[model samples]
Target: MAEQTLKEKTAKGLFWGSINGGIQQILNVVFGIFLARLLSPGDYGLIGMLGIFMGVATVLQDSGFSTALINRKGIKHEDYNSVFWFSFSVGLICYVILFFCAPLIADFFGHPELTNLSRVLFLWFLIGSTSIAHSAMMTKKLMVKERTKIEVSAMIASGIVGVVLAYKGYAYWGIAIQTVTNAFVGAVLRWYYVKWRPTFTFALRPLKEMCSFGVKILFTSIFAQINANIFAVLLGRFYKEDQVGYYTQGNKWMNMGYTFIWGMIGNVSLPVLSEVALDVKRQRQVFRKMLRFVSFISFPAMFGLALVAPELIVIGVSDKWLPCVPVMQLLCIWGAVTPINNLYIHVLLSQGKSNIYLYNTIALGVVQLLVVVSMLSLGIYYMVLAFVVVNVLWIFIWHYFVNKYVEISILDVAKDILSFCLISLIVLCITYFVTKLIFNIYMLFIAKVLLATFLYTFVMYLSGSVTFKESFTFLLKRK
Candidate 1:
């Protein structure tokens, strides 16, 4: 009966999560098109230059306590209060430090405009920090529906604000304002939807208790951010802002593709895995099921994005953004498998093995930095290609650690995803040849999307893909 309940809860979470991701992506595409058309790559590049700083600051402000709270079996009001105050304080401090460091950042990038641009952009951390506890509460309760409402509302409000400003010639400032507005709106909505309110009372013990687990997560997140933004940092220093802009645009689209899958997997994976954490057998079962679901969705989505990069970018954002195409395609390769890596990490976290997660991520960040630095002279395309190759291959390393706790071997991991991966590749290859005769880019785009969707669906249905069948059934029932 408990297993049945979990199954239902998982389904409901996936449904809402998918809606959240889908709506958010659509809004992103809509707003992204307008802003991309209005703004230049250098405009995005200016903001992209601040990516690492903002990412690290945001990570520091949250301090991994949200995940810690979710992972805890029991929680008290004081715990949430303590986290709220702690996060609020940390956000203030990080912002202040970055505010003063802005000029140095600008100097490093040889863009004096970044001094002011970064100071304004840095405000998102402050606005976002206040909602950490509230957001964590929603995640813990699996309130994806509420979270979805909050996210979509925030995106729409911010998108309108961003588009208007961009249309008014605000340049990168439009993007920056949009970002800060999203945080502000989401924070406000989180407070509104989450009933829990923090009291003035705060305690050190709870913070200390969670910190032992959270501190590892903290460092792990830090390294993870560094790895993600290393390219931006390197490109900013060694190349032009427009070059960094191109990579940023590419990485952004790649992120949107994978984030759609990761958002759904993330909303349920940890909380559900934690529920079954004490039962090795049950945890393994849940983990594999989620793995299959992620594989079924991720492979085709990312591979298809890569296949249609040229048409999508040209039609959606115009040829001025064309330089980002190769970069996007290369990054899509890594994006295809990133959610699987995330699922493996969640398994480790659910089992209270954050130290392993930390070490592995630290190693990954180090290796990625070295790899990117080595390939710097070869230009952006090769650098991104090498980066993608390194990340995709790092799945084995993640598997090595996860196996120690979950006993999910590399072979088991490969078995779950390899078929989906191969099928997606073959289908896309066939679609490419099948649609080669079409000359109009718009028709070509439509044909590729339709033909690929039809082929992949027919294949999955014919092969009796349990994941596909279950997902389709669930949607039909929901409808």
Candidate 2:
């Protein structure tokens, strides 16, 4: 196979990434509707409470080797082999420990059933451990099409298992099994796609070399997970399962919207940026273009999701889930800004500034944890609101580091992204008012979505958005 030029690689990557994210979100929405209807709030809450532990364990299992492998200038079978063995070993150890610790976790939550649930749910980490090297290899080679197939198929298979089990009254157990199945399927498919096979060559030298870069990433990933899942932990501890469930439902929906946009950007940005790490001019150009694309989709999709949350929730999962609507609305704002921070960190990583990524994530995570903890007495709503505010303010913080590293100033970023943000907000507000007179929730939701989409697209077209025009042209050309 001839080596693909950077332009060709990037275009192909973005194309597959868009398809992957779009299809994944659609599948998730369909499966989610059925599962949410079949299960109770307490069921989702049970699984949600263990999110932090599961997240941290996942980070530890991979131990940042995947990013380390990607950032490495040269590749060898030994490098991949060492990572595979190391991760598998680490995952096995973590699972054994967590398996025994499940009792303590259950005791803390006052839910005896969690002892078994935790043991079963933690299998995802073990399953995922096997795929780290394969995934890294695929990502480094820009094999987005294969990866997209693995992920989408895994989601579909797992969704079927979840819906069936939930319908059979398995509750949280169904959710756990579904997750495990997805990881298992992805791992299997990754191994099949990437022909690299590990030998009996267990070498410490490759492991040590990668650990220098990987360790910082490991801790950074851990802190990031902790920051993200701290709410589930806090809510589980201080509030009822139902309360945690409400927040879980909302966060799930909000994540779907932003992840769609981020998914497309994230799949291509890191590897592409890494390829141009040495050229400041090229990096800046590439980064800004990505920034604009992400902002253009992010602001409208998330803000519009917030607008339609009430209707969407009621129509999809029934009125019982209405309490989650406000929480979902607030989280949609956080979701909107996540990609900006994510892109900045990816840029830093490509520049081999893992220390910067580690420090910034730790500082922010600690602060957010303290703030959320302090507000526990107030309410979950206040805590979530504080989370959103901190996240929005942190964009400047992210931009500061990005500017220092790449000479892309805050003003440059704002100029590129702010127009989309303001326009999307205006369009959503108008759509909301226009649809407020509608009596049916389904009609109101559909109207708001259509109106917002048309208005945003028309405005971008009128305002001469190169990103919008280029994206349209790119898809048309691909078709």
Candidate 3:
């Protein structure tokens, strides 16, 4: 296959990619409401505790081959078949290992219930392995439009199914069903849109090539997963089960913000940047565009969320999550900077410059744990402060690495950052004043969101940033 232009991939990928993800987010928000009503915070906490290993294992499943397959020019069918077989095998092995190791894992956390939960969730790997390659094929072919359609449908189906089961008193089965069905349905649907299929034929040579790069990627991914999940682990150990659940749910909401914001960047930027894998100059331009794109949206979203954290928790998750309000407030910092930080991280990885990014992430992960430990050592209020500070460190550390390699220019990033800050400041101030009239939590929050959105769009228009009218209409009109 001939290499496509970066603009073509970026235009197609980011636009439809964001739509696919945006559709998923809308469904999740609705589903979250239902699930919160169905299950208590302790249930979610139980799962979160068990999920630390599963999360790390999920990251390891990628084996970096997805990046390799996407970035390497002229990848062949044979190479993919080999990669697919490798993933299929590793996934099976992972499930088996985790199945037996479940009790030990739960023991490590000193939670007996987690044993069964971990074992039950490990079954997802078996399901995941059965459909490993088709999704990769879809991405390789740049089928973003079709991909999004299936993804949206799958998310809707998964959410509805999970909510119904939870309503029927399935307990963690609700969570379990949603997790597995999402993989089961999405993978099956991907095969329908994708053009390639892997066969039984596999070769050691191709596996070796893929694994060589994947080893680095795999360990880096593990480090990242462990780092991200550490807080959940710590929460379970140092705090009450209810506290863990609240924090877990809080992070889930924060992930809603983080995922939607970063999902736009990741789905768009990674593949787009991969096409220009050899050209640092063009890569830098693309990176800046994404950074600014994120700032234009993420800054305001995070600011507004923080402004209404209390109400959001109270109403969004119901009173079961009141304990999470503080954690939600703290993690909002991570949410706001998520786009830029993630773009730079993806930029580094797409270029195979994982070591530096890995270093920063690992160092920060350690720092994060230390901060959490220190804060927990002192008290809960200080722990929240530690959480926020760790995220701040994450932002600067990523920016520093991005500056070192991408060379997109610090001033360029600062300009985007400064503008977003100013925009958020003005809009937040307006929201505060308007709340005097619309004092109800829901109404004031809505007022703030709508007003701030209009103001941000207006400022973006004045700055000649990507405007709605110019948003690649091909995505919407392709029917």
Candidate 4:
């Protein structure tokens, strides 16, 4: 097989990554709409409550070794072998500990049902640990086409199972089973594609060497997971299950939106950037282009989500989910900028600056947690508002490190993305005003999305946006 040029590989990766992300989210929206209507808010809350435990356990199981493998130079079979065994062991340990502590977890949330649910739901991590090495190998090699196909297949299979179980009145169990199924299928596919088998060799030397880099990533991932799931914990403990449900629903939609843009960036950026990690000039060029492309999609997609939140919630899942509208709106703003933070983090990671990533994540996580907790008296709205503020501003912190390491200035990033951000917001505002008077929810949602998209594209075309033009040209060239 011939080695692909970097540009060809990146273009192909982005193409498939976009398809994978776009279709996956569409499936999520379909499955989510059905499940949200079929199940109650309390059902989502039950699952959401277990998020923190599952999230933290997932971090421990991976033990940061997949990332260690990605960033390591001349990675050997021993590295993959050591990580697979280590992750498998950690998975077993974490599950056992969580299984025993399920009662305590239920007790903490004051929900007896969670005792059983926690044990069942935590199995995804165990299933997932078996695939870390395989997944990392594909990621390291930039096998986006294979990865994308596996993801789409898993999503369809899991979506059908989830919807069937939910429709059959299994409630949260349906959701839990869907998650496990996705993990199980994805792991199987990864193993089938990678064809890399672990030997009977168990060596502490490779594990120890990787751990030196992996430990910081492990800490960072733990804190990052905690930061993400803290709301579930707080709401589950301090508020009603329904409140947690509302937040979960809103967050789920917001994640789908951001993950769409990130899908293209995440799969390609790290591996591609790692190839040129030592070439500051080339890396900066690639990084800026990625920033512009992400900004082009993110700002409009997220802000447009905020615009149609009310209509999307009411029409998509019925009025039962209306309460999540405001929460979703607030989160959309936060989601808009998240990919930028993610891109910079990968740049740092590709350069082996894991310590910087760790420090920034911890500081941001602690401060955000403190702020959100402090605003508890003001309710979920204020908590979400505070979250948006901190997350949007934290880009500066991420950029500070990027500038230090890669010499990509804050001004450089802003210059690349700010125009798209401003233009997207302008388009959204115009679409909102134009569609505000529409009385029908269905028409209003469709019109707002269509008009905003058309206007954003038309404006970008008129302005001859380089990224916009490059995208179309690339698509045509690909055909």
Range of the 10 consecutive residues with the lowest summed lDDT in candidate 1: 405-414
Return whichever of 3 and 4 wins on lDDT.
4
lDDT string for model 4 (277-389, tens) is: 98888889889988998999899999999998998898889998999999999999999999999999999998899999999999999999999999999999999999889
Q: Which ten residues in a row have the lowest lDDT in candidate 3?
A: 466-475
Q: Which candidate is the best by lDDT?
A: 1
Error of 4 at 374 (Å): 1.2
Which residue runs does candidate 4 get wrong by more than 4 Å?
Answer: 1-4
**Which has the higher TM-score value, candidate number 3 or candidate number 4?**
4
Best prediction by TM-score: 1
> Across residues 1-479, which tens digit of lDDT does each residue of candidate 2 receive?
22247877887888898888899999989999999999999999999999999999999988898998888987898999999999899999999999999999999999999999999999999999988889989989989899899999999999999999999988898899999999999999999999999987799998798777889999999999998888888889888999999999999999888878887868689988998889998899989988998898899989989998988998899989999999999999999999988999999999998888899999898888888888999998999999898888988888888888799877889898999999998998899788889998778878998999999999999999999998999999998
Which segments of candidate 3 are over 4 A away from where they belong? 1-5, 379-381, 463-479
Error of 4 at 252 (Å): 0.4
lDDT per prediction?
0.93, 0.90, 0.75, 0.91
lDDT of 4 at 448: 95
Q: What local lDDT does model 1 show for residue 439?
A: 97
Provide the clashing-pair count of each candidate structure: 0, 0, 0, 0
